[model samples]
Target chain A: MDMDMSKNMERVMKDKQEGLEEWSTIIKPKTSVWNLYIKEIWAYRDLLILFVKRDIITVYKQTVLGPIWFFVQPILTTLVYIFVFGGIAGISTGGIPKPLFYLSGIILWNYFADCFTLTSDTFIKNQNIFGKVYFPRLILPLSIVVSGLIKLAIQFTLFIAFYVYYYFQSGIAPNYSAILILPYLLLLMAGLGLGFGLIFSSLTTKYRDLKFLIVFGVQLFMYATPIIYPMSSIGVTAKEILFYNPLTHIIEAFKYGFIGEGEFNGLGLVYSGVVTFIVLTSGILLFNRTEKSFMDTV
Target chain B: MSKVVLKIENLSKRYRLGEVGSGTISHDLNRFWAKLRGKEDPLSQVGQVNDRTAESISDYVWALKDINFELREGEILGVIGKNGAGKSTLLKLISKITSPTTGSIKAKGRIASLLEVGTGMHPEMTARENIYLNGAILGMTKSEIKKKFDEIIEFAGVGLYVDTPVKRFSSGMRVRLGFAVAAFLEPEILIVDEVLAVGDIEFQKKAIGKMKDVSSNSGRTVLFVSHNMSSIKTLCDSGLVMSNGTVSFKGDIDSSIQYYLGNSKNLNSFKSYENLDEKPGSKDVDLLEYKLIDKEGEVIDSFNLYEEVSVQMKFHIKKLNGKIYPNIHVLDKYENYFLVDTIPENEIPKETGIFISTFKFPKYIFNTGEYSIGLAVTSFPGSIVHFFENPAIIFNVTEDDLSLRIGPSTGMLPGVTRMQLQTKTLKI
Candidate 1:
């Protein structure tokens, strides 16, 4: 009877051991550079969506005009740009209406700037939450990108209203290429913003000086991208220097597609696309490496 | 015979001490250059053990070193240690909030950690919305939160203020709501830090009960870190003690507590009396030595609940005209006096010399807990305190089987002392 009881106990223990061995997760100090774990990110999609919603809703929760600030912000910036660049400086808008010309560039620039700034500050701003819980660290920056897109969609509608108003006033139809290249332009903008933001976020954890540089650097980059002045007005030497900037082609392409009035270079756009891809890939690699140890340093 | 659900192997974490940004870029570049040249990184060899009191000779220090343990299924493990003992570092590593420097952890199921209460709560968001946000941050799905929504509100007792902004809620209400959500997480493995100390006593009790239910009834594992010994003993099955970034002991909860309390200030029962300049005492008497001793006449800092123990005190007198008697004040862990033992004036000394006094405590006097002893030497007739020392020695008391039968299954009785009361039955 004793031997039989011992055998039964052994079998029960084996079953319990087998039950626990069915599912396990192993945590290690470093993961391979190639293992992006896209499936894990996909599993956490709901969390990503909730974060996006929180960012958008909480930004204007207490303001008197609430979300109307989304439209009012771009409208006010565009008015200032038209006065300062178009009316005061007599800058040519390639024959497009001044408001229409300036609002398009301002709206798109605001989206990129907002996305870049918010995403770049992810590691510093969310250190408390990150230090306490385990979730995909990428979710914070990805949600910032998504929330910035939502704001852009709202501001883009305002741009479209002016686009229609100018189309009748000038009787100039938008180029057919605008329909085909709009998605690509937006993708390029997002890729560049996300890429640069990731790189900056990872670097700033170690050295905080970059955090101060980014605010002024974005404004300086805008002048180089032909936001206020047309590309046709610049000399050959200045144009060549501006062509080296990946954003230069994207903005030029956006203006050509929507108003049918700027220079179009297929090779330059291809170069911009290639550069964006490289920057984004390297950015992700740096970000993954930093997320493992940023808490210790930050 | 339970299955091992979590295994940590040779875990270690090294950190750089002092300024975070001083020449770190040059260090990084130097390490990179050395790596490219196929040479050693130079800085990895100089790390010392994590001792904050010592002057740092190198920039690197090991926050944790060679930690290895296996936790079985449904086992509630209590981690107890002093500040800077790397308890939080261990939790952060297990939760994957930070990575270890040299080892790996294999866990069987989903792990959720409440390292801090209301970690990601946004003040601008309403209480209900903050619940969803905090829950999502803790790895719960939106649908999972929805399923437990009403229960969370009911448990938090904030149904009327659900729509109010979290900033407007009282701190107590916020803690209640935060703990309510975390308690309902239902993960396979739960890790809790010192978050339970935030709420009121009633909520703390409820939280401990819910933790017990989660581990026992649902067959989940739990890792709890706390400085509160009573709650740790009540909620945990086993315990791990950390000292100087290493696991000093791992065993059943009772002995672990004893070992932790005893070895906290070095393995010694005696504390040297020094620095009389700040002490409140008359120059007529000076305390020399104070310690607790077992029945074997050997120095001890811990005892069983029913064990006979003694307090040995040694003092010197510069001049004595009247009899000097010794009085011992026994205080509980919270410093509440429960007993005072004093000798008669005739039993004391009247001559000027060094003296020794031993006081005996019978069995069944002290219940299961920690007690600190204070000593006072006073004159006779007028009974003025010549010299007094508070908390001369501290000791721990463990529960005995005989005492176990006299109380609830929770292992403690209602009152402080366990007396031998007489009872009789009358024919009626």
Candidate 2:
């Protein structure tokens, strides 16, 4: 053991004398859990942007309506809910216009859903490219988050158009002070969705049964949040269950700021922020671990 | 000597044999049990895999083990091996696509590997978009790609289709575009894995020239892996031979090729069939012994670049009616026949009982690579025949004298007329 240590010391000294200052890259079997390769991800930011562009452009490149489909999807979904849940089921919208209420909740929920589901399939969908090339593995999921953010912005603009249209008809004006919290709400959504997606993406590579469950999982997750219905009508006991859900606070706050119907608690927002931080950190940790050997199992 | 840029030490990788997810829970439990007791992987056997036996008592197999080598700046190292020789494993470890199971690889500069061209190119995207996207995926900054955008387009010859979608382009056009983007990468270290097998012959030559130009003109280091020996001989300055997950030989390009051919193809400079019934030829004439001999009458498989070697064959004829002569066929490593030697009709030997024939290949007449000879003892070409044996015996000629080699073998090897050393078959 002593001889081995002395030999290593001698080798290190010899390497220094040979002027081998530093290595730019070193690959090994077991790296630390916290070595998430953030520097590499930063260097590859351009690739992230390009991937987002490819998703946006290629999705509508062959469609007849092109970018118009982006608006049509939300509008169609809003009408379905108005018919099924509003007119037929006779559910109350807490005195807000049905179109404005459903549209706001739908747009924000779509952003979160897209972030979770798209990134969850990152490793499986990109096996070919990942096997052949070397880049930061986090770039693909990050790109999904960015592209979903852009889509959310567009749909939020549509939501605002409806807000003003209904403002003249029914006097449903947004709370300007509450609207300032919208950016913070979106950040929470991005972080939470990105975090859960990264964890599931790593897990699904090893256990493909999770892939089948995730689509319905996202759908069931939507109901657990305050997307289809208002939080005002729920009982205190039931509301407590929904309050514990981080997404519940985000969706409720987004609605309260938009049409002034749902409850907005500062404590709940802080709780959601803390949850987001925890999930995001763990997601990155799991993602870094899986990226090292996913090619073998994937 | 140049500074070393890439150093691999004690590199190894182990992989599970069967399905990854099937019954993995039990295996994980077993692994936990083993590790808690401080034991090696319970599912794997010890020792390296080899040509004879690879059957393991456990479910895991070591794909690579204890590999070590280094590459200096401006050196082009060609990695050659048969299937399942762990060549791809080594490349994956170096390129950072997959982490090694043990040991480490330290590199000085950016390493770009063209494992497969058009890796991330989407068909729905335009050619211009794909070029940008592909360049970025290969680790080029947007500004760097923009600076070389025109050069890339010109090299790919796709200026007219810049705005057109890539799906409309033919497969050949896509390959050209992909390679053009990578050729302008200007990375300090490059690793390529058989990507040259695609495209037309003309384009393949152009790609090889581009790689050579990069390594030579800019002092970049490259590790190229290919099954094509001619390409390896053409583009690489040094060579590494792999067999069954281990480095079999590492040396100059010529010796590595010789070593690989001799090892993988089971070629030898000598062969003898002492048994009467198990010979290679027909019953009428059977070969007894065949070998290569030097000036001291010593059997040798290898010689310096400028040295004389002789092919000596001994055979016995049980019955012979008409004229029979022994002919020799010499072929290079890629099996291109270099020469065919036979006696004139009048000078042919006949009525043979036991015969020995020897032919001389003069000094400086052959290039530095592996060569094999085919033997035939036959009657008249138009009529009856005795027998023919091909790939009879293989020998290697290597050159350590750098002054003798013109350049990396870019074109045809040296022919007989270039050195002008000729000799006829002798009855000894």
Candidate 3:
């Protein structure tokens, strides 16, 4: 109750209108939500670099074959999918070489899956540091997206090698559209992963049982994502259902854009982009609010 | 007086306690039902939580309530409290690690808190890298961190190891390096919590000295929370003593320490049992409770320092009262044990229903410190049957002529009773 404090309090009270502020209060929540989406995360760019470096360093520490695991994980996963789906199940790789087809899907799908899984556990994984300090909480989930992108880049290099080999040996030309739309595809994957991850991260803080469900849920979600088989192989009714799968449009558009024989309607890609934007925006809002009071609950 | 740098008003934090058991969910539902209908919390109102056990099923308690205080620029304020007294919660609130459920806090400049040693330091990172990383996390700019990088290294006293991974450093070395970086970051407001409790005495001294320099040289406000009374007395200009989450006493360091010590000494009743578990150095025989009374058998608070104050003890000897004698000692506020007096065995009566002894303080010889009485009934000189050291009963010595000296001095001057000392004066 000093004069200076009274003056400061008056300023704060003036900034906060009483009756009319309620009508505009809806705007407050929305802005808090949108502010989290990209603006606050962009400010924590240095933290993103540090987290990316941390993720890379921590993974290879104490292992003899360092950074090689980055290449080995996607290669082994693609081989397993190709053997099971193409060889045993008699699935078609859409007339494209099986390795390139499987490698491409694995590369794109892993980025989304990795981002989703890591983002989902943002609150739980860093509970120790989060409890003791306050920074932009979005820095954590955004960093996960960035680090997963780095990993995707390394795996994508392997896919590039496969693409070159397939071009020379089997004479399949990668459509020029693939090069133009590559960055947008990356954004679509990041948006979807971040959206799903943040939703789960917020829910898991209060209901810890969701954390267990998320692990198995992400596994089941991968099978449903059409990574092993193209949407063209499903029956007509199932194909219609697959269109409702928002990620299907993005992945299908990517395949058609790159391999030229896959599905690539511009409107379908736009629908996928719109859905990604909505999820990313909503996820940021939920995440921003959750970070403010999570210390009390978590 | 300096300018105010940080202000906190009407802060409160509530915590739900003891709802972690098999049937807690059902109990919590019942309590919530009671609360919704304008009734008090069911468990808390009824005191249903068993007092005998350490755990309870109470619904909620305010860990901190209505805490208000301000800090001036360059002032070092120490927060002292017992366990469960919400000292850490206050620090966490000011650092903005957590927001208050109510109230507003405003700061004048960037605030950095060293709530834990080497917080956010990745073990895989080298010492040099961790300095930059932790510094940036504490709100220091990259250029600011780089500018002090050499000074931090020098203060940590770990040259050539700057390139070594932090995991390779010893725990003490890691703490030193972490603290060194925080000190050099040159924040406008520094918040530290019991991080100095780790490391050896040498490092503790170094950390304390560095904190002193940081507060004095840079004129940065510091909020320090510690359980160590001596450390608080040495470092803080003002102290805040918290009890049950409210500011109970705020003023000079001595007054706050006095308030804290006074709480521990419950002077409600003149009679109590000297339980060995409650007090140290107590053996078999039970010396129930003792009261400081006058010749009229009336309990009193102050003594003339020249008049004899009698402590009457009620006890029972299971075996023999053959060589029982009472030993008393006077301790100051800092717990520097001063005088020890022993009663002769020959003066005790054979029937031991009650025993009393009176010792006179000649003339207020002690300095300005909270003085507490300690009583011990010993069998012979070596073994103690019941002993209470530093009991809650506290008093202070007041004087008109106590000159504050700058440095360490040796010798006893003109006083009624001279405490034995040797003085030396040499010209440099």
**Candidate that would win on DockQ:** 2
Report the poorest 10 consecutive residues by lDDT, candidate 3 chain B. B45-54
TM-score of chain B of 3: 0.58
Q: lDDT of all the models against the reference? A: 0.85, 0.86, 0.73
lDDT of 1 by residue, A1-298 (tens): 9999999999898877675665467888888766788887887888899888888999999899999999898889888988888888888887778888888888888878877887789899999999999898888888988888898998889988988887888876677866598889888888899999999999999999999999999998888888888789889999999989988888888888888877787888999999999988988899999999999999
Classified by CAPRI criteria, candidate 3 counts as: incorrect
- lDDT for model 2, on a 0 to 1 scale? 0.86
The regions of model 3 sitting more than 4 angstroms off are: A1-44, B19-58, B265-428
Alpha-carbon error at B20 in model 3, in Å? Answer: 7.0
TM per model?
0.78, 0.78, 0.72
lDDT for B175 in candidate 2 is 97
Q: Which stretches of candidate 2 lie over 4 Å from their true place?
A: A1-16, B50-53, B268-428
Weakest lDDT window of 10 consecutive positions for candidate 1 chain B = B271-280
Q: Show pairs that collide, candidate 1.
A: none
Candidates 2 and 3: which is better by TM-score?
2
Model 2 clashing residue pairs (backbone) = none
Candidate 2's DockQ is 0.63
lDDT of 2 by residue, A1-298 (tens): 9999999898778767665578888888999989876788999999999999998888888889999899999999999999998989888888888998889889988999999999999999999999999999999999999999998888878987988888788876567798898889989999999999999999999999999899999999888888888888778988999988999888888777778778898899999999999999999999999999999889
Residue by residue across B159-185, what tens digits does model 3's lDDT show?
889988899999999999988888886
